[model samples]
Target: MRVETIFEMTSPYRDSFRIKGFRFGNGEKTLAIAGPMRGDEIQQQYICSQIVRRLTMAEQHGRISEGKSILVIPSCNPFSMNVSRRFWAMDNTDINRMFPGYSQGETTQRIAAAIFSALEGFEYGIQLASYYVPGDFVPHVRMITTGYETLDTAKLFGMKFVSLCKPRPFDTALLNYNWQIWNTKAFSVYAGCTSRIDSTAASETVDAIMRMMQAAKILTKTVTLSPAYEPAVVDESELLHVKASHAGIFYRLKSPGSSIESGDVLAQIIDPYNGQCLSEVKSPADGIVFFAHNQPLVFENGLIFMIRGM
Candidate 1:
């Protein structure tokens, strides 16, 4: 295993910030896995760390395929991670929203440019991604419906679900979208949690990545984990959104991965000052809960749940 600083910047008030990459094997740039562009993505970073550790062992054991290489960047914004801030500490800009960035642009844009330059030519790219909202997902692999995306390849991860979302205008600047536009097959792996680590989900994510590598012939041998399961493929239209009508303290009655029927009580919004139940959020469709808001508070019209319709 070889470790290198892919990007570095000399900070005026603190130590130099460096984005490190761990390389395994030698030859073709077969795969690149990135993690934690945002500081609060603890689970994303943790999953990437596990991938690096496993790859290191595989490299040492000569299990990595000959003439193929894998790179893992466990954290992209270490400065923000150090301070526990979600975006750029100084400007509050998101590194993820600055993909295929300009070198002369703002801090996050420059950082994105540097990282993308180093990762551009890989055959496949995987990102440990989190939802925009603070919530728990049902652990799945997601891909943009860019022409370059491969749904078959995404299913190789063997997660519970494979979601394909049509790219919106704002998605054009995201790493996965940019990677696809650059002719790289990019995928985003979403574990169950973001800021908090879910050990079972993390393990499942690591296993899924390993399974994908093995399936791609990038890994000559497989890790001794359980066999990968078949995943259900769903498009964005199949997901049903549940929104909060009133702002208040939020409490969830149903968790992600739970089965739900129409009109089932999914959560409750409580009046913060009056200690009264403000609203009872109910499921609008018979489906499986794909995501659920886990945070303590909710705003009016906030997306609190996503149900994958049966």
Candidate 2:
């Protein structure tokens, strides 16, 4: 295992910021696994750390393929992570939204450029990603439908769901999208929770990555844990969004992975002042809950739940 500072910048008010990467084996840049680009992605960071630890052991045991290399970057924005902020601390910009960035642009752009310079040219890229909204997701592997994306390769992760998303306007700036455009097979793995760690989901995520490596012949050793089930392929368009109709304190009656029927009460928006039920958020379709808002307070029209129709 070799550790290196992949990107660094001197800070005026604090210690220099550095993005560290752990490299295993020595040959083709076969895989690159990156972690949180934002501060609040605790689960993403934790999953990446586990990957690095496991890869380190694999490297010592001569398990990594002889001619294939793997790089694991556990965190990209430690400054924000230190203070528990979500975005870049200096300007509140998202590092993830500055991919394939300009070196001469803003701080996040420069940071993105430096990170991308070290991460590019790999055969496969995996990001421990989180949803933009504060919520819990059903563990899944997501890919942008950029034509360059390989769904079969993504399914090698052995996640329960493989989601193919149509690229939105803002998605062009994301790391996964840029990696695909750069000819790397990129996948985003969401491991249930974001700001908090879920050990079971994290373990599942680590196993999924190991499964992928074994399937790709990047790891010569066998993984004892097999995939629980074949992943269900779903398009992004198939997800149903349940929105809050009134601003209030939100309480969820169903969690991610819960089966639901049409008109089932998924959650309730309570009037914070009067304690009255402002609205009962109901499921619009017979399906499974893909995501449920985890935070307490919600605004009018806020996304309360995401259901995957059966």
Q: Best candidate per lDDT, number?
A: 1
Model 1, residue pairs in steric clash: none
Please provide, for model 1 over 146-245, each residue's C-alpha lDDT reduced to its tens digit, 9 standing for 90 to 100.
8888989998998989999998899899999999999999999999999988999999999999999999999986667766878989887779999999
**lDDT on C-alpha atoms for all candidate structures:** 0.92, 0.92
TM-score of 2: 0.97
Q: Which stretches of candidate 2 lie over 4 Å from their true place?
A: none
TM-scores for all predictions = 0.96, 0.97
Kindly list the per-residue Cα lDDT of model 2 for residues 117-232, writing each as its tens digit. Answer: 88899999999888887889999999999999998998898888999899999999999999999989999999999888899989998999999999999999695975555899
Report the poorest 10 consecutive residues by lDDT, candidate 1: 220-229
**Model 1 — TM-score against the truth?**
0.96
Number of colliding residue pairs in each model: 0, 0
Regions of candidate 1 where Cα sits further than 4 Å from its true position:
none
